[model samples]
Target chain A: MFGIRSDLPLRRDTASRFVVWLVMVLVFMASLAVTVNSYIGVLIDDWNRSVTGTLTVQIPIAAAGDKASAILVNKVLDVLARHPAVAKSEAVPRAKITALLGPWLGNSEAISDLPLPALIDVEMATEGTEAVTAVTASIKAAAPEAVIDDHRVWLNRVMSLAQGFGVVALTIMLLVTGALALTIVFATRASLAEFAQVIDILHVVGAKDGYIAAQFARRALVQGIIGGAAGLALYAPALALVAWLASRVDSEVLPDTALPAAHWLTLAALPLAAGLLAMLTAHITVRRALSAKV
Target chain B: MALGRKKAEEISGDAVGLEAVGLHYDDGPDVLKDVSLSIPQRSFHFLTGPSGAGKTSLLSLMYLAKRPTRGNLKLFGENVTQAKRGRLAAIRRHLGVVFQDFRLLDHMSAFENAALPLRIAGVGEAVVQRNVNELLNWVGLEDCKGAYPAQLSGGQKQRVAIARAVVNRPKLILADEPTGNVDDTIAMRLMQLFVELHKLGASVIIATHNESLVARFPFPRLHLDRGSVSILPPLASSAEFDHDDPRG
Candidate 1:
């Protein structure tokens, strides 16, 4: 609309519309990849915080009537409480510990007859492995039978998996951007060829290369916006369905998939970015084609 | 016959000046050669020749559509043979060309096709509307303003092309066989439109082989034959060559 309103026809054929739809699908894929990556990052952070600087002390059942095991557990708790690096220490009640193992060991009479260790949960005042190591040593000196489990091995494995997912998501985003740019270039060349006579008329009428390029750029930008919005519309409902499904599942098994407000805002910017990419690609292509003419 | 009356009174600067200009296609034979002439400002001339006489090629040079292979050409007093491509558009804006094909865009209506020049020049919308409407009406196509080029007859499309050429009141108009597709009556009407534009201080050049039309008008002639040009005298009166004209 900003250009000279001539009878010069714009692309309205099926081929052109297919180009727009292709761009929409590419943008949708890119947005979905980024959103998934963000969610993975949140999950990793949650897992890390849940495990960092925390230790579980387990004392095996004593040869006597459970009195010796209770005394060893009290000795481990006393050592953790007095340690400068310890924040809070609590003895896990037998019922709660039994409930934690209910899914694996079952709640039948056989589970009650089995010899179970007394467990003490310890929260450390300082983070990192060094503090946890020092606290473990102090606990071990008091109760030799106590074993300290800091959860570092499992945390490392989860982080490694999250990083691998991040790499894949990044690769997907790059591929989508590349594909969108190529589609725009192809569409511009096709449009230029289709309207060759119209371009000649415009040139004869004294329209400059910049002016012609602006016409194409404006048209491509509008198409980009429409396609981008359509892609986002599709992504939104899919994201909602995924969130609903995630909510129905147990959070301990699967981290919460619902994206935060900041991540949604980030995804909202995808359409605008797509529009800008389309405009720039169209402008460059048109100018390059016109430069070859008289 | 009055030969070069305007050329004799050449006190004013020429609208177009060519000195030994030549043109040829890529690795092809020369299409135009050694053409030297000056068209004084506001004068009307007819370029007459047979087909394949490089009439369109010569006009293409005048409109900056092609650069001459050799020699100097001045348009509106500026040396444009070597002008940069970026600067050529400004000079081209002062020229209006009517192609033999009647190049009206098929997508635009008659009014929009005619309004192209003014719009390209960034004229105000109100002025473009008024000028385009008045010109369409003057060309006798006011009723067809909303019609596309495909919907119009040959004569109507030619008229639309002419209207587009003069819409911005260009300083020079080069029409290549503007009436080639129309009847005698429509051709004469189109010539009259050019005459009116010439009277308004625009130099006009019409390329045609129709001797009858040339004899009907006493304008000077730049006759081209075998890639060469010669300036011929204007007929003393329309009656002198009216009987000898073959196209009559």
Candidate 2:
């Protein structure tokens, strides 16, 4: 459908060449922003899925023995077992806790004797923060030094960070869209000026305004398709490289984000949408200009 | 579709009719003043005038290139004085115009230029190729079929223009100085082409200062002077309207 040959010349004009490159650049940037926004959405979803209804209990060493820390963790575990909101609880192994600290402190024998806190993993059968406050109170009563870490504060911080990136991506997309429309309008108008005599000749030869408009619109649509394809082609490897970079980031606070399949479909369709938009823009611009003429 | 029963009945089958038509660019004196004429279907006429006479303007009006500033005009029994652009374009489909400048697109080959009207009419590709090639061959541009306008000589471009104009077999053919750029032999050949088209039911109008062409062809002449027009019968032996003749 995008294969219509342009009655007007395509490759000779500088304005149309600039139009193609501008479309390519704008579509590339817009796709990146849109997909990044999509990725952030997935990350937020993963955060909600992984962290909700789960709590971590940390019993401080207080410069005491690991045995004492274990005793306090057992007390908190007993409290959690009796609590209605807690479906299950298990003390995290000391070796596992030490290994978790392996990032900051090297796995030397001295690091194991550094008196780290005891940890417990808690899974909740109920929803929301109200049950979290009740469990905190019960655990505090059993062992005054024990604390329940619902991770809500950290989750809230991470959620806001993701939302901020989402907002930036959305803004970038909006700006890129505006820039693309204006660029197309500018290029189309330039073409109209350059080919005004051809237009007059066409009209004399019994061509309707729509016929002339179609000649230009078809060229613009083809240019859009070519530029959009090139842009997306560049974007694919860049996105893969981003995914690779993300894979390199090993962190306790952040989960790996994978763009959803639906998002990939949307990105895949961007070039066609750009093509249609260019076609529509050229059509309307020419129609309006012809309307004002004899 | 009709103004009224009587009004529709009053409409004529002339290819073009103008009554008291006046036209001018914005705020300018009328280029065509109080012009009235009727071109009957399948007839031929030569439009003749001195330099600065309104021959080109009258041809433009007849081809619906511009609307008359004031007056009533009709084409093919339809009132089109102030017709919408779409209606005018639809009417223009039946009109074939050969401009003075031979306005072939510089980017298109002579073959492509000849195929323009048919393409506009949505003719299929096979038909477009077949018809355009035939027309180009007949116009003696077969060797220059794929040559662009800039690559062709003036006479070659004029032939391309004429071929493009008549390719669709329009009901009316309007030519403005069509043979101005060619030798007498080629001009006669081109005029023969128009005569053939007229025989095939096309109303032909040629606007030119070529008195010899007017005298050679038996067609009546519509002579324009100072934005007004008068019908003049062919005078095969007279140069009364010839400015350079200077004979009484």
Question: What is the DockQ for all candidates, taken in turn?
Answer: 0.58, 0.63
lDDT (tens digit, per residue) of candidate 1 on B133-235? 9889987897999999989998899999999988988889999988888888778778888887898999999999887788778789999989999999885
The superposed Cα distance between candidate 1 and the true structure at residue A31, in angstroms, equals 3.2
- Name the docking class for model 2: medium
| CA deviation > 4 Å runs, candidate 1 | A1-7, A11-15, A59-71, A140-146, B1-14, B70-73, B236-248
Candidate 1, residue A65: Cα displacement in angstroms equals 9.3
Report the error of model 1 at residue B31, Å: 1.4
* Model number with the top DockQ: 2
**Cα lDDT, model 1, residue A224:** 84
The 0-to-1 C-alpha lDDT of every candidate, in the order given, reads: 0.84, 0.83
Reference contacts preserved by each model: 0.60, 0.78
Off by over 4 Å in 2: A1-3, A57-76, A91-120, A133-147, A251-254, B1-11, B236-248
Please name the candidate that would achieve the greatest TM-score relative to the true structure.
1
Chain A TM-score values for every predicted structure, listed in order: 0.90, 0.85
For residues A171-290, could you state the per-residue lDDT of candidate 2 as single tens digits? 988888787778888898888888888888788777788988887788778888888898998898998898788788874344675578988888888888888889888888899889
